[model samples]
Target: MSQVMKPSTAAQKLGILLSAAPEDFQQTPISREDLDALRENPPQWLQDLRRNGPFPRDVIAQKLGVSNSGLARGGLTDPLDADQIGELLANPPQWLEHERSVHRKVVAENERLKAERARQGN
Candidate 1:
């Protein structure tokens, strides 16, 4: 039997985020055969993803110099292309600044706590 891939699984293998994908992708299960077919003869969107990349959220966040949580909090549902990321950096919104601040604070606090714990030997 041909293995069936849920939309989520397909999205992962393709290195794209589920929320970032097109609506049609979310609506169905993709069989392995169909995925193989796409791989052989890519569509425009597939080409774009391959060329720009179906980047995972972590890579996206890091490349953008923001936290993963910041991305989520900013309602960034789509995986960004390099151009999109560049645009955001060129003119970041207030929310992005706020989220970056929050992420920085959280990281600082986490480091402090870890250091404290180590000192206590627990």
Candidate 2:
């Protein structure tokens, strides 16, 4: 017997919106094997979604090079599609710039701390 997962869980694991998924996908639970197969050889719809997404918060944050909290602080509460993300990249707002700068500083600080710990044999 195949292990089954909820549609919402499948959507989360697949990194696509449940609402945007096909009716069959949204309505039906997926098997573990099927999910793995989807990952290994994605269908056109899956490819399209991954490529031109109203992506999840984490994906949006990654694309914008900022943290999820930064996104909220910057007033980006809605999901963004590929076009919107591209537009933002082309003409970044002041908030985006600020968030990016802050993210850079945070990353640098974390790296510095890691190096210090390594040197101290932590």
Question: Against the true structure, what is each candidate's TM-score?
Answer: 0.56, 0.89
Candidate 1 stretches with Cα past 4 Å from truth are 1-51
The C-alpha RMSD in Å for every predicted model, in order, reads 5.5, 1.6
- lDDT tens digits by residue: candidate 1, 17-92: 6766678987889999988887788778766765576567876787766798789988997767777777878898
Cα lDDT tens digits for candidate 2, 2-121: 899999999999998788889999999999999999999999999999999989888899999999999999999888999999999999999999999999999999999999999999
lDDT of each: 0.79, 0.94
The top-ranked prediction according to lDDT is 2
Minimum summed lDDT over a 10-residue window in model 2 is located at: 12-21
Clashing pairs in 1: none
Clashes of 2: 0
Clashes of each: 0, 0
